[model samples]
Target: MASPTRPGPAVAILLARGGSKGIPGKNLKPVGGLSLVARSVVAARQARSVAAIYVSTDDARIAAEAERYGARVIDRPAAIADDTATSESGWLHALGLIRADHPAVSRLVLLQCTSPFTTGADIDGCLAAMEDRQAACAVTVIEDHSFLWTSGPDGFGKGINHDEAGQRQRRQDLPPTWRESGAIYCVRVADFERVGRRFCGPVALYPVAHPPVEIDTPLDLRLCDMIARSGEDQTTGVADARLRPLKALVMDFDGVHTDDTASVDENGIESVTVSRSDGMGLELLKKSGRFRLLILSKERNPVVSRRAEKLGLECLQAREDKLAVLDEWLSGNGLSWEEVLYVGNDINDAGPMQRAGLGACPRDAHPSVVPLAGWVVPVDGGKGVLRAIADRLLALA
Candidate 1:
């Protein structure tokens, strides 16, 4: 990472206020298969000039999610967490917290979790602009020349044209203008503290004209969802179809979630050891108002059944030919294969795992299964494997 060019000391402040009147909890909402917070965290970390990343939020859930995504969380005070609190206010409060720790922070990069389209490259470029221009601050904008109507100091103004009979002017003849999109803002920390505004004297404009639409309402969220999911992987540029809501989460039993260990009792009953970390991960995943979970196990052990029931997971035990059982379960539940994610650990699971829309395995999974997985959780089984996967998926929001 290149050192930042903002005066002296610098840090990135990611503001994520919990309350949203236009779109509730929109900061945590998903875009491109990730929550808005997750996307920002990833991008911030990727920036070359960023030394550290902090997420400011009042909601414990948002803080927990941010930490899981590798961002430091600063507990946003109630005074600055209200719906009416402006971004400028949050920036100042976070600055105070950052200054106390570093004591010499001279630059503050105010990042909003509301927009997900900005990339780490965009952030690095914006910061680099400060180094190049030696300006007080740098802000992002997009060129927009579409037909626009403006109200004068008086209300009710018309479009640019005044006469109906006039020939349509060429598009280039119109004045080109840039609109602030709140995608990225870079400023000197000392300058920001002195003046309560995000921008200061000699503000440089960083044009990020890449196609962007900020999420400010339910309609905006839905539209971005459509753009992210339906967009083709091809170069032509169309958004992927929005992912349908998760109906069910199909998980594997041994080695995929729980450690492959068993304690044999004096009476010859076997016990499979599980981890509390795994349970914690599941609770967060379930709390997100997404899928109904189902655990499939080849073993018929009573312990497996007990644990599944304890976690509110539907269990299918002693299941051979796992695909057939999965099909039957979907038919009975009126669900489809594409809505399910199959997690597994060994070659035996390959057949069933391949049939699901998304497949995952732990890093310690069988070598073959690792290649088959769409995403491999970082931790081994009995660890926070599920949580790793959930956090990644959540960021895609």
Candidate 2:
């Protein structure tokens, strides 16, 4: 039975392995510009109820990546890491290792990397549901309204959730069914250990708003990427949450402002074209007075300064270490990284982009930076990057 008072904060255990027949190295595969395993860690870290995060993996690369994202790695045995091993085996092994060190951990959370859209809020909701309902387990689920069928032994298709011979019922007439999202699962550690199963007792279902997006094949990966790029309300509520506290908007100059191209005359005069629409968008944001804007450029060209001056935005030029500059600016302006949105289109911007509250990139940005971006604009660099982002953030306000 769930105790009204929780014994302690939950610990999240993520299982990521190396081999995948459907998509090779699936765990490391990037969905929405972040690796599946890394995204899971990010979501776990964001959960206020999660006290510790662990990754159970046999692959060295997965282990390293899990650690890179601030999760402790549990060296899963080669036997259990193979395809034949059930997920329960991995969780039990990881839980034993976790309990050895953190004896006070009573709540156990299992996060799946395949569910790319899982958010910290979802995890917390599941944990809260388990506690509030006094249930032994809670899992994320989504409302399902669909007609199901099954091939009966009589060699005829029969309705599974409804009567085929009876009066046809509207989809809305059917009682709602809860389908597991396979995102977050919270359970009492003792119950799981004793029963050797996730659903050891009464289970609570915590419904999430986002549609289920699980990455198992290449097509799923592509679809997730598109959803992430579109930044839809259904799937991007977590990302939009990051933008809610936005106090500053920092942008990289070259690709973001100039299409990463320049025209040179015989006189060595270089010129670049910018979108007037983007200019208007930035101007509107400036007028709104909600954000402090700055253009950070690796180029020392006077054009960078002139453009910033024209826009009446702060300028930081020729900074190889853009994150260091960003840190100083945040500290000086009394802001945190979680309250800033940084946009970049190249390798140099990757570090700061990942460190910012929401890292965004253009559609045509370099392959390296694309995966590192949290949001990708539909348009290419300099074509309306600022305008697209401006519209989204302003709408949120």
Candidate 3:
């Protein structure tokens, strides 16, 4: 008897085709405040067995989305992107490219963007099944109890699982059958290469309790959105554990509070717009009694002070060196950097953001500041940035 093959590092490949006949731009469609491709990449990142993640696509938007979620992109060819093309061709191309740099990867985990409900645990389960059973491939399946039927050439419906002539059997007495979920597939690299197919040799079925949902039409997309909004399809929590025990919430006024825009009058007086939702968020935080809020701005504009007063937050203005002011204020209040959560949106806020314990920014924040931010809200500034952060903080509280 031969010993079972040990599982090795595996690379997760997510195939996101750019063209969709049923639903246009379906891959980039947002579900639960996250793009479909981004959700898949995040799920893959959560798996411990997955060493790296790669997205194969021909669409520029999909490629950018994949990179935004921290996944390498494999530019798929046009030939393989047509409706007649198959997913296997794209997978083979991606595997070849990945093997060029990561030769140690022995297994391939194929994920579909259509199946948004697939979790990281499902991928790990499939990998475990392949290793424990010593099978060449493992595929996800859902326990299906429906009686199957087929159409004959004579245009008559015939039973495929039971004899139509015999008495109907009880549902409990029916034999167990499984339906392909089309969510996840894990296979040995060597076996896949040998047969050029996902199921080359002995295959194992990994069963999951949740029914798989694939987005193939507009109805499917709307159903997914509804499920996500209902909080039933929430795959992961957006809150970060490192933001706990937060004492102070500091923020830059211009880009962090407003939309990074100012209307200047002929007299050089400027005004900025702020979100009412953001003000409500500040009120909630203040009511929590767990956090002290402050606004630090480089501009000496009275608008900043006025807005800060409206929110009942302490305001510091005309600070050329924001970090110095922040440190001095921390020391004066007997607070440390570890207890502060700073939010900024531009290069001016970069230094201070880095000095804080938890740094965050809006979705439209400057590129340089984004890398420094520990959290990036889904909404832009002056829209719902503060509201989003406040929700996360309140959840922790």
Candidate 4:
């Protein structure tokens, strides 16, 4: 019998250290309502080719946030997590660990938390470029059309892209130049190991349409936040299509159904308040018979099941790995992720939200969760959030 070839690996690696001289806790800083670490992980998860995502971080908080966004955490050594260490150190260490656990890993997609605007399409582009060109590495870049100038020792500006003594030429006449985006890099594992660097053997450039946005200081963070908000405002028309799909609707009970707050008496009994309007909305959705509704909760409290019972909806409670359970449920129910809409309000719900076709959240959802949501209902959690979302989905119907 002929030997079978191993499948090419689809893995992504990210490096995030705790120390940041320019901006303390930089990896955890929110830009677009999501921490940089979470944003990168979500991007990796979005890529159709990516099967495993690993984050190398020494910081406990960064590791927790990365995991919340669907990434495995690699405990980076103190030696490689410091400011002085090059990024290659952390990536090489992570590669070793990832390969040990997943021996089939053949290539790695490296992502940077500083590049908050990086998306799954960018990663996929690099991967495709590498494969199509048979290159060892591929990187994201943007076309640079701006004229370049440099000050000489004689205190005179000199043109670097064109002849200063000859007649001026149109910008379009000049040869195209590409500037590295510093957002995504795809490299063959063997080539990276041999060269001890990202760029090895033949390199390919995957040009991206978006401007290069790198976060290095506080001002950059603020600017990126503004850009994100502007994008959200302009993307409503596209976001509406996410609601048009029908098959299943999954929700987190505590925050999506309640106010994310509860009271406990001296006797140890806990009580929570929910909106009757939300119940009516759920009833209407049930009557439609076009959607499968589920309450997926991490809380072990009995009230979760009680509420689901009253609403006449199926409920799964105390799920530590909501995404895993949700996947199993989807497989059993014969539905695809693209056909379902997920609603959540906190860190724990991030992974499932990113995995679903459409993610919806209450206005007051955690900052990290907000960026993952396709729709942010006007109402806060437990404040008729369900009613508001149901109205929007039904309007499309």
Choose the strongest candidate by lDDT.
2
Question: Which of the numbered candidates is closest to the native, going by highest TM-score?
Answer: 2
Q: Report lDDT (CA) for all predictions.
A: 0.72, 0.84, 0.83, 0.82
Q: What stretches of model 3 exceed 4 Å from their correct place? A: 1-10, 45-52, 117-181, 200-212, 231-252, 290-301, 314-361, 366-376
Candidate 4 runs further than 4 Å off: 1-7, 151-155, 232-254, 262-338, 344-397
What number of backbone clashes does candidate 4 have, counting pairs of residues 3 or more apart or in separate chains? Answer: 0
Candidate 2 residue 221 Cα shift, in angstroms, is 2.6
Better of 1 and 2 by TM-score: 2
For model 3, where is the 10-residue window of minimal lDDT? 231-240
Scored by lDDT, model 1 comes in at 0.72
Candidate 4 structure quality by residue, lDDT tens digits, 1-397: 1112343887999999999999999999976666788778877876768878999999999988887665889999998878789988888999889987788888899999898877776787888888887888889999988777888789998878877668987888777888988899888888898999999788889998654678898998888778765643211212344466758989898888999999999999899999999999989988988789999989788888789999999999888999889889999999988988899999998898888888888867887887576565546799888986676566664
lDDT (Cα, tens digit) per residue for candidate 3, span 1-397: 1147565689999989888889889899987677889778877875668988999999999998887665889999999988998888999999999988698888999998888777767788998988888888999999877777899789998888776778998776778888888889988988898888999789989998654577888888888877776644434333344668579999899887999999999999898889999999889999998898999999788999889888989999999998899989999998999888999998899888888877888867876676456565556888878987787787774
Candidate 2: segments with Cα more than 4 A from true spot:
233-242, 250-284, 295-304, 316-391
Q: Worst ten-residue run, lDDT, model 4? A: 231-240
Q: State, as a TM-score between 0 and 1, how close model 4 is to the true structure.
A: 0.70
Which model, 2 or 3, shows the larger TM-score? 2
Give each model's clash number.
19, 1, 0, 0
247-320: candidate 1 lDDT, tens digit per residue: 57788888866787778989999877787777777777778767768889887888888888778778999988
Give candidate 2's error at residue 230 in angstroms: 2.6
